[model samples]
Target: MSIEIPGYRSGTWVLDPAHSEVTFSVRHMMISKVRGTFGVKEATLIAPENPLEAKVEAKVDVSSIDTKDEGRDAHLRSADFFDVENHPVMTFTSTGTRVQNGDFLVDGDLTIRGITKPVTFEFDFGGFGKDPQGNYKAGASATAVIDREEFGLTWNAALETGGVLVGKEVTIGLDLQGALQV
Candidate 1:
């Protein structure tokens, strides 16, 4: 006996930012975790037959970062961090993908403040289904560790208690939904 499996087809999928989010959390002086999210961003995935062959790209507007604190958010967009005026956009382009035990590891180049570095995220496939309006949708989530200093976000202060402010490792999370076009 022989068996066959259905494969993904060629199409351009648009990310539903309204339902998707790019969020992060970083330790503050090894004490508390500071969490924030980027609001204005978009991503596209082109998966043709094989998810590994997909081309993924994402663009995030620096000024759209929000931590729910006006003062901190403003400062983050200033010269110390994202520097929204000079580098308004941060982007990511996938280099390749690997699947293991029903999960994916996507390796990509992330560009921030004119600096480009490779990063890989462990992705969870959220199953494929069609919406009520007949739109095909697929969901995925990924997480990765990043160094803020690598992106030139080195601004910090020494805490009166003991340690220096901010942490070296930043955790990034992505919850994405893509609309497949056949």
Candidate 2:
């Protein structure tokens, strides 16, 4: 089967920061999950007539992490996690795209804390349409799970019970809205 978008066109699409969000979730306290959002500094999609041929590049501000807890957020920004002072930005660059079992997948390199690793994100296209301002827009969401330790984020506390305080797996998600450059 071939990938198809209802109104796909070739052009540059700039991410609408106000309508886009970068979120993440990680297992906390070996029982529950903690979620947060990051501020997107910038992102662009170089689209092609064939959606699978498109390329994407994005940058996220590491210091914008908000887990609803100031103290925990501060710790995440420190050397134990993101180390914002040294690595203020995390980035993703698409390398390729493919489809499997009727699902679209985007293969890319995700860099965090100065470490780069290949990751694949399952993508779901939310279709295309024109906004009230008459600008063409596209929407999509993608998600991927990664081992924090693979990115050098090995900080954790031993629990009195058995497991660690923080889970090693982290789920990263992106809800994006982009306007086609006219």
Candidate 3:
């Protein structure tokens, strides 16, 4: 199932931390939204000769979660949420890729707080570019939605207005810029 990633030559690539990010957002107080980013620890993307068979493995530091408030960040790193001391990292590994509606769909397993579940990311290949230093680069974006409770992140408060303090569903977005290493 070979599908072309436009402008990208088939090979392995490494995500450039300076240009890549993974962020997530969740509804807060049933009205507003809170967003945070998890720092990328490392990643390797194997763009196979048959691109559809590509594989990507990544780890994100849960302890690096930041929402601008140190208090909240501490709570997220505590036992109530991510429990970064026990589970310091969240990980993703793609199982396969398929095209639908002219877009690439990556089926993968997302693990958080020791819970592993199958999820899909809407993948977009951003083609190729050359850095000033002459290094070839390829970019892509991926987005997915998941249930926080499913991953054991169920802490919340009930509002007198009738809704919970935090929504159960979370949206995760990944913008990756990979430098071709081979």
Q: Which candidate is the best by lDDT?
A: 2
TM-score of each candidate? 0.92, 0.97, 0.97
In the range 45-85, model 1's lDDT, one tens digit per residue, is 88766657778999987898989899999999999888999
| Reference-based lDDT, each prediction | 0.85, 0.94, 0.91
Model 2 segments more than 4 A misplaced: none
Q: After TM-score superposition, what is the CA distance of residue 14 in candidate 1 from its true location, in Å?
A: 0.9
Model 2, residue 51: C-alpha shift (Å): 1.4
Instruction: Sort the candidates on TM-score, descending order.
Output: 2, 3, 1
Give lDDT tens digits, candidate 3, residues 57-163: 99999999999999999999999999999999999999988998898899999999999999999987777989999999988888999999999999999999899
How many clashes show up in model 3?
0
The whole-model C-alpha lDDT of candidate 1 against the native structure comes to 0.85
Can you give the lDDT of residue 143 in candidate 2?
98
Residue pairs in clash, model 1: none
